[model samples]
Target: MGRLSGKVAVVTGASSGMGSEIVKLYAKEGASVVAVARRQNRLEELAASLADAEGKVEIFPGDISDKAVNEAMIDFAVEQFGKFDILVNNAGIMDDMAGVDAFSDEKLLKVFSVNVYGPFYATRKAVNTFKEQGNPGAIIHIASEGAYKTCAGAVYCASKAAVVALSRNTAYMYMHDGIRSNCIIAGGFKTEISTSMGMPNMEAYGKLKAVLGTAPEPGEPTEIAKACLFLASDDSAYVNGAELAVDGGWCAS
Candidate 1:
């Protein structure tokens, strides 16, 4: 039951959905966790709810898109615990389903900032923290099916593609140091990520809905969390640079 005993984890986007589930499971499996998110109250509630877990849950409230915040979170974890062993870059925002012709400069910037830049900043900090500790660590980037298909808007798709590339490159770069990085090619799920898409482009949404209509039923948050646990634990010691599709066969179509 102690899958992650003695490890310390930092999970971004811990306020809800898969992020919340990941925190819960990691704590129960005996890993100290620092939950990072913009909502202070939500993070507090989340940490309190897991008070009886085998491991400890703490909050690091801030917008992960900020570079300094990213670095600070890992540092906070190390200060609170002895060292950091895992990083889950799960916090992300969705983009309005806008095609190339209708791309909004503001939307492009916002989506890239949160979805792409947030993970990049967090990864850099976590890698450094692991190196300082002289321990092998795991990095799991929550990518999307948008990386390979048109489920989301062009910008969102491009950002996810970049994330997959980041995971692969990071895995290759640190293979000699035993730092593993992997990407979760997520599929349709009943999550709050859509709330970020303020006023989606109608034409683009229509096309996306058509493609998604053929996909399998949406998955639950715990499903993705289980995959995260596998990657974070030593169960996947040999699994690196993989684009693990957790989309329930939606990507096969």
Candidate 2:
């Protein structure tokens, strides 16, 4: 049997990058998946790809930073799949490079809204559902290496650090309920987020390869997806309040 057989999972930011991979992997492992994201078209495409898989997949599109959206996500999961087993709070954002003084309040709030409040709201909803359903479930937050290491700017790094602490404390608080919480500290990946942040187009991609002694190869979302699967599945029955680093050894260097 697959690792997630007889399970149902909800993954946020399900349209692309790590979130999309988590959604796909969970379904492949035999979990009925509720894919949540703001991009309805992308979510629909992902859902279609998983349609013929061993597990079921459904798509819900909305801005996770909104509390109403978060509540609807949980409601949709129950309405479609009957129960919830796992929640991957993976939606987030980064700001353009700016000094603390230079950063705009609007930008800071936007980042926090999606990165911090989004997960917080989603977790609250998920925990409530888990309690009412009387099912032991897992919640995994996709934090960044920034959470533990020094990184650019203040907002993104600080927000992620908060997420790390949130997961740890929540794990301890809900252990008796058989609900587990964890965070994945990921390294830099060549995702749309990076592209939007002006990482390198084809020309600069080559120049960077020449200068930085070759940029560290980006970590695949599937690798992180497997980690999420381990945590969500009974394989991690004893694992809780743990921060798993999927940083491709960036912390070592």
Candidate 3:
């Protein structure tokens, strides 16, 4: 039997990168996944591909920064699959490089709204559902190495740090309720988000490549997805409030 056999999972930011991989992995492990993202066309394409692979996948397109959308996503998952077992808060944004004093308030707020508040809203809805059902559920947040290192701007780093803290506290507060919370402190993953943000310089990218060996090799979305699967499945029954780093040893150096 697959690790996630018979479970229902919800993955935000499911249109691409780590979120897309998480949805694919969950389905491969036999979970029915509700794939949430703002890109409807991409989500539909993902759903179709998963279906072709004999996996159950559903699409729910919306901005996770919106509370109503978050609630709707949970509701959609439950309505389609009867219950929700895993909630992956993977939707996030990174700001352009700027010193604290040079950062624009507009960019800072937008980054926080998506990176911090988006996960918070989703977690709130998921907690309510898990509480009502009284079943064991797992919440996984895709935080960044920025939470621990100073590579990213202040706003992005602070937002991710908040997620880590929130996950730790949630794990402690809801252990009795059979709800487990964990965060993945990822680093230098080659995703659209990274390319879109535009690194400070080619030197910075080259430095990361030298340390990690390549942009896309070590931190593939599929690798992160596997870790998330382990946490979501009964295989990790004892794991909670843990920060799993899928950074290809970048943090080590």
lDDT (Cα, tens digit) per residue for candidate 1, span 1-253 = 5899999999999999999999999999999999999999989999999999999998999998899999999999999997999999999988888999898999999989988898999899888878888899999999999998998899999999999999999999999988999989999888888898999899989988888787898999899899999999999999999999998898778
Kindly give the stretch of ten consecutive residues in candidate 2 with the minimal lDDT sum: 196-205
Candidate 3 lDDT:
0.85
Displacement of residue 30 (Cα, Å) in model 3 is 0.4
Top model number, TM-score: 1
Worst 10 residues of 3 by lDDT: 207-216
Q: If scored against the real structure, what TM-score would every candidate get?
A: 0.98, 0.91, 0.91
Order of the predicted models by lDDT, top scorer first? 1, 3, 2
Give per-residue CA lDDT, model 3, range 38-132, as digits (tens). 99999999998888543499899899878899999999999998999899999988776565765778877888888888898889889999999
Model 1 TM: 0.98
**Candidate closer to the true structure by lDDT (higher is better), 2 or 3:** 3
**Which of the numbered candidates is closest to the native, going by highest lDDT?**
1
Best first by TM-score, ranked: 1, 3, 2
Which residue pairs clash in candidate 3?
none
